[model samples]
Target: MQPVRRSSRLTRNTISAPETAASSSRKNSRKSSQRRIRCTPPPEDSEPEVESLSEENSSEEEEDMHEEILPKETRYENSRTAFQGLYQEKPDLLRPSKKPLSARFLTQGARERTSTVADAGLLYTVCDSDSFQPSIVREFVANLGDAEPRGDGVAVYVRGSLIEFSPSLINTMYCIPHCEEDSSWMDEKLDKVCTLLSGNRIKRWEDMSSKYLTVTNQVLYKLVCSNWIPTMSYTAMNAERLRFIYMLHLRKGFNFGKVIYNQIMRMAENTETEKKRRIILPTLIQQVILIQRNVPPDNSDEAESDFPKLVVKDKKAGLGSGVDSKEPDLEEDIDQAISFLKGIRSRLKRGEYPIQRKNEDSESG
Candidate 1:
């Protein structure tokens, strides 16, 4: 093989000229791309930003809280508690220094899903329907495990169990003590009932009031010495009107009074039932006394006229029965009436009948 000499610079460049032109053409066709850069405001144009007052993020919830019984708001994020209320509170409502409770993230899931334990203490609205959807009832009763009822609070049915004051009040209705709101409510209802009796809103008011008088309003009377009598101690807006209703139509207009009296009368049918006779007589006397007490002194004459004649016919039926056309003020009459009842109870328990009617019945028999 023949020896070859190395090429000079001119010859080398001539060989690479085609590649160089290709590179130049590619460079000429390529476009330069620029990056976006955000610029901060210059120091002269910048001003301190104002922080709007509102609740901090979830991390702020871990702050110290000393209250043993915190308000229900802490559980706002939990879906269970969120559905329990009517509306959600806005975060802006929280004060600048405070945050919601941290423990709310842990909802009462285990306690609810596994147990049928009763929360009898909670106030619940009695939903009246032939059949309630199971899901609705469950939702209504959920998260109510810690509630307790008081002061004219509502009652309802859940899983076939009575909730609120209803369980204690259903059979023994007279035991329901009156409250301030209860009195005002009753006054409004009574006005409605009066309007109904006058033929105004007759259909709606009659049906409603008939049910109300019987089942809805139980605060008007109580049992004492085994007798049902109107409660005299309840505060009243119009004493005279209350007296009139209780005096002339107590057993007639009032639902429970009629039921109680009918039951009492059934028990008192036999002459040998001295105990019932004693209750009946004392109950009548107490009724008179209550009506008398309710009658304002200025209208004593009207009250005396309004009182049933047969009850006061004996003239010595006790409790100033002889005071004609004006029943005496009975504000301090309960104790006296109670004392009289005790005396009657003693006599009856000893097998003595105070009224001559039982002897007459025995003769007739």
Candidate 2:
């Protein structure tokens, strides 16, 4: 009777053949296969398993069907320790091999771009630490007024802080634009960093705790040994600048080598302005000894003199050349010291500079 008067509505609603049953079966199969293909993420209390899918022969249609059956916003996360903000790949999948972590070891143009990302994270970890408990961090979050700037970037100094003398640290954070062809992006990144540093008022490394101090020191050490700045050259810094650097390391119980003295002298000699260089020369020599935690030798006969004892002699115009002249021989002693230094160098080269015996009997006797 129904076949004689079959209506479209009834036909549409009716489960006609075993095809419907088969469809149901297919859906069940997909759910089972998908569950096996991708395991449910482990519960918080449970350890995660690293499992590979065994559905190598699974058809694309079947895969698509499986995807359609799965619900959106699954409560799953990767077992990897990496932060969720960085990667979004499926959990339990095998990661590919990777090269060394060092930028120096990395090949090609990878390092140039990664320099910002990798180092940004490095600096963040540093700047984000809680070591400022003993100090202040300036927070640099944005939109804070009536804030005082405590330090200077152009003339940076650090007291009892090793991170301060890090020229690379300063260079990396400074806002100078990049010189590369694709510097727009790099410059943007640099500008963003520099703004962050400035806005937060982190003019000194002492503003940051020692969270990433190791990396920071290593970077500066490499930069120094390589005779390089990140985006600039190692032109001679003046004595005031060097004193600033020296005091930073000194307070941290750091010592300078004799090479530092030679380098400073070389820079002083290279200065075009003779008077200015002379002024810096004595101060630099004084700082070198002071920072090394060494007492200056007593050169005065009375041992208590107004002049500061250092590598530069304290002899004034009274016992100096051009003493009788009206115009000051502003560089008289300095010039003699320079000449003496040159003589020492020449004698040392020829093995003629020998140690003088203080207790030798007089030639007259």
Residues 1-365, candidate 1, lDDT per residue (tens digit)? 75554566668788899999989978855442343445767677365443432244332444534434465666555655665453455554333454433434233433331121112111111111122232322322341333345433333333344344222242233332222221232244544444323223222221222212321121221111122333333322233333333322222222333334344334335424453342232323223223223312332222222222121121211122111222233564678789999998888777687466578778999
Q: Where does candidate 1 have its weakest 10-residue lDDT segment?
A: 120-129
- Candidate 2 lDDT over 278-311, as tens digits, reads 2222222223223334342334313321342212
Alpha-carbon TM-score of each model against the true structure = 0.15, 0.15
Q: How many collisions per candidate?
A: 2, 1
By how many angstroms RMSD does model 2 differ from the true structure? 31.5
Distance from true location, Cα of 241 in model 2, Å: 10
Candidate 2 wrongly placed segments (more than 4 Å): 1-190, 200-266, 278-284, 290-365
